[model samples]
Target chain A: MIATKRRLPLPLAALSTGFVLLWVFVAAFPFIWTVWGSFKVEQDFFSRDSWWFAIEGTRTIAQTGSAFTGDGYYGAWVLRDFFSSVVNTVIVTVSVVVVSLTFGTLGGYALARSGYRYTFWLLMLALVFRAMPHITLVSGYLLPFFEMNIWGYMPTAIIVLVAINQPFTLWMLHSFFLSIPKDLDESAMVDGCSRFQAFRLVVIPVMWPGVITTGLFSFLLAYNDFAVTAMLLSQPNQTMVPKIASFLGTIQQEGNVMFAVAAVVSATAPLFVLVLFFQRQIVSGLTAGAVKG
Target chain B: MPHRAFFAFIMPSLVAMLLFIALPIISVAVQSFYVQHERVVTEVETCTPFAGCTKETRVDAEATEKLRNEEPLGRFNGFGTYLDRNHLAVSEIGAILSDNAGFKDAAARIYNLPFYRALAFTLTYTFVVTPFAMLLGFCIALGVDAIPPFYKGPVIFFSLLPMIVTPLVGALIVYWMASSQGILGATLQTLLNDPTLSLKSSAAMTWITLLVYGIWHNAPFSFVVFYAGLQTVPHDTLESAMIDGANRWERIRFVVIPHLMPLATFVGLVQLMDNFRVFEPIVGFSAEANATSLSWSIFNDLRGQVDQLFGSAAATSMLTIVGVIILLSPVLVRTWRDFNRR
Candidate 1:
């Protein structure tokens, strides 16, 4: 009886694992291919050199012939508009992180600790912007921006990027801050910290980790966006996504160019995130915020 | 934070959002009533240079200039944008509104046909991606939580891989992979022994790739969220569940899942919203692809067409946004109570 009982959950766990593995397999190849292909040059790209080989000699020579091992990353990064991609990515990502955090934390804080009756309207307002298809936003804005030169000076891409990144942080960090009891703030105020001081000195320090996690997501999401970059930028000013898309048409085009840069770009934030999340408390905040939502 | 300064701290985001997001919505709304300039520029540089290498040239300017000379730029003709682009006399929009027979037949048609279809597409898309993403996340949470502590960090980080990246990149990656000529295209084709795989059909390609892609991108995020939820499970509830001889699934389903109901609901609802407006991937898939949803089609009318019709596209978008708000109401109502309580 016990054996039969234990077996029931086994299949569920296994099924879940199978699902995870299937997704992982699907997710891994393009990423790995991106890394490998980035090393090969144009001649190799056209030769269908993207096709993998191991232990074979002649084809590998032809494939590896034009591949410059030493400077590929540097070429993609500092030389071949990669530096600009990094700059654009950084500018957009950093601004998004700061702005989204402010909105999310404050919005979430209001949602969490307020007696304000209109908070529902505010929350739903967030959902409206969050839920709307970004393409619709892109489509609607293009004509107006073209007609009205006021927004012309500012890069339209950065503006949309912020809008897109805002909802998630609001959702994630709202729960994070809300979970902290109102009494905690009340007590901080009682201890003579002004409400602002209580938030800054008391509550903020406690929720700093949650803030970091949300900020990390905002920065990363802004950096890697394709459609925004593709639509917003001119070719010379392309961020990583448009750059990747240009490299993306076919195996006939340079597929490896995307793969290599993606590998590098995707790897950047996760490294810092992993380091920051080493402590269990912060790591769990992400799950808590997401799960509770 | 004091209420006043706290409000002040939040003002920057609010202002940025208002200018970029809110005003754009208003601008689009206003512009929707006016016709878009139909200038066919002969020699604008292609932003994506790789897609073009031919000498620059032009033709359509003749028609636009003639039209402009006859009438001032941005002149509006009533309700034409909604129907003309589809090349359908009474598109599904007209068919739906025709039932009303109360409003002008044209107004009825525009709202009923295109508006409903756009709403359906957005709702279906969001509903499809959200819960499953949550499930995938919760499973990851279970796995990482079960593991020895050191392994959690690496696994969690990797799982979050998609979450950390932009949604646009996620779509691009999937588009590249699912294409017949992409990196894994050959592999999948080889596995099937057919020159064509599922990518041959546009909608099928979207569903398969988008679903899998959504999971791949979201599982780690969901895991992190669910894991955090798991941490907050009061010990008393767990002890009680164990004492009752409740299995882990029973504990999770009864005790744990209930606690996450608010969360699961929110994530599910949000994902529903995200998916409903699922324009980028379809657009990314290409013009040749037949899987264009109502949103993508409406957008094409405004921006992606031989003729740009700004008014009707904006109207349709407004209608679509309204539908999403309706869908969000139940969750917003509940969250409101929490926001108000002492």
Candidate 2:
């Protein structure tokens, strides 16, 4: 039986349930509709006469007796060669995660353990950088990169993304390390190991969960980034998000709107799967700050 | 860790941050004081009797290239770009103030300046979106809390969809739906009984759509935070309040919200910083005509293929940093105090 004091009346409960379901519909419907629409002809999917025409079939598709097509996916994947962008995105994201986590773990652990005034200042400084928009740094990099002739390379972008990811990485990892007791490493040190040895053997094993959570965020940041990748990388070196943006640029002139639609769906699919699998880590990562703050 | 170990651990991050993050800021600040210029050499061609030609001046490309190589930083013009119409618009403001114009007229004149125009929308976006997202998020948290436990995970997962997707992709999803040919757009047009009314057609509608998208994209974050906060609200206090005849609204107003205030602040601080950038959505919406932001202005200046306005973009970036510092100072001050206390 429900607790009499806590449970609301049936009418009120029903009303709230209805509202919640409505909101869920609002939140999830667009992606579902778009995914379905991606497989249909543009006219049928965006039919003027009825919103259900895509489900029912478009004029051209109906006359031809077909309800679905793959032109969007074909044009995007085969014709546009978007797979290279997928490769670029994976390379950048992986490099950013690996490089950033290495620095973040060492630096954040040091910050958490150190009692010096500089540690506080360094963390605070990272906060300032954290708040800075990446576009600002892109402008600063342009002239120098042009002079050095390294403006449009994937490695340069990956390095920049890693640097940009560092502040948040350090902050989160710093907080996460603070939760682990210092005595574990100290005991290891007392037992005849150097500080680095103690950290490698004692602290690192327990730090994996936090590091994994932090790494997930770093990966997301690098993967989802648009401004830095869009501005910094040249045409051939463009990542997936920027490539999708490039599609938007020529979408009108080339009549490849469906290509963009297909690309958007494809780009979102990984994130959906990531959220499903790593939902716990993502949630914990989000709330970690909330609880600490 | 000991001092040597600490230094060893921090050195790589310090170097990276110095080279990439700190140096860029200094570079931008320096660049803001300088303008890029094409080196021009004026040469006089004297008419000769044999040639029987008029004297003419011509550009010297080699000399230009040499000068550019020698002084790549360009000529120093300290605060000139910042004070110009593209940025602070100090002179334009002075003119408007001297005229003693009405508020609306002065605003119109000021909005003509690119910097102030972007500032206006950026500020509007920051102030409006933060509060609205918080309020809507709180409501959603409450609504979701009212339901049974089995439904929570799926509801939260779907809610996460809007925020977890890339900002540009998420904004495009909403933007495409709000286009005239899409279902919601078509339905809204029909419901309004006007075939021609389109979200793409109006400035006010565009701003509203962006705000809605902003709230949609961000509210889930606040919801997740607040929902976690909600779970920790003491059942004893709620039960006592109920025994005291406290209704749902009263109990919520007095008990629930107070408990969540700190969490709300966390969400607000994060949202303020995130929303202040506001770059990707504007690009995604292609609402550049109706709306521009500080970040967008920086992007626009740097993106011109043949004409990169480096000085102006740098100055705008400096101003944006200043704006972020100003807007976030209170939080920073509190954080500093808290850190000191700890």
Best by lDDT: 2
Task: For model 2, state the Cα shift of residue A68 in Å.
Answer: 1.3
Candidate with maximal TM-score:
2
* DockQ scores of the candidates: 0.32, 0.67
Per-residue lDDT of model 2, residues B229-335, tens digit only = 88889888888988999988898899999999999988998899999999999999999988899999999999999778899999999999998899779888998
The residue-by-residue lDDT of candidate 1 on A3-78, one tens digit each, is 2224446666576556655555554555555445445443332233344431122343575553334344655565
| lDDT (Cα, 0-100) at B323 in candidate 2 | 88
**CAPRI quality band, candidate 1:** acceptable
- Root-mean-square deviation of each candidate, in angstroms? 8.6, 2.2
Estimated TM-score for each candidate: 0.74, 0.96
Question: Per-residue alpha-carbon lDDT of model 1 for B241-323, expressed as tens digits?
Answer: 78899986798789988987766765666566656666656655552243445577665665453556666667666666676
Give me the overall lDDT of model 1.
0.60
lDDT measured at residue B31 in model 1 versus the true structure, 0 to 100: 61
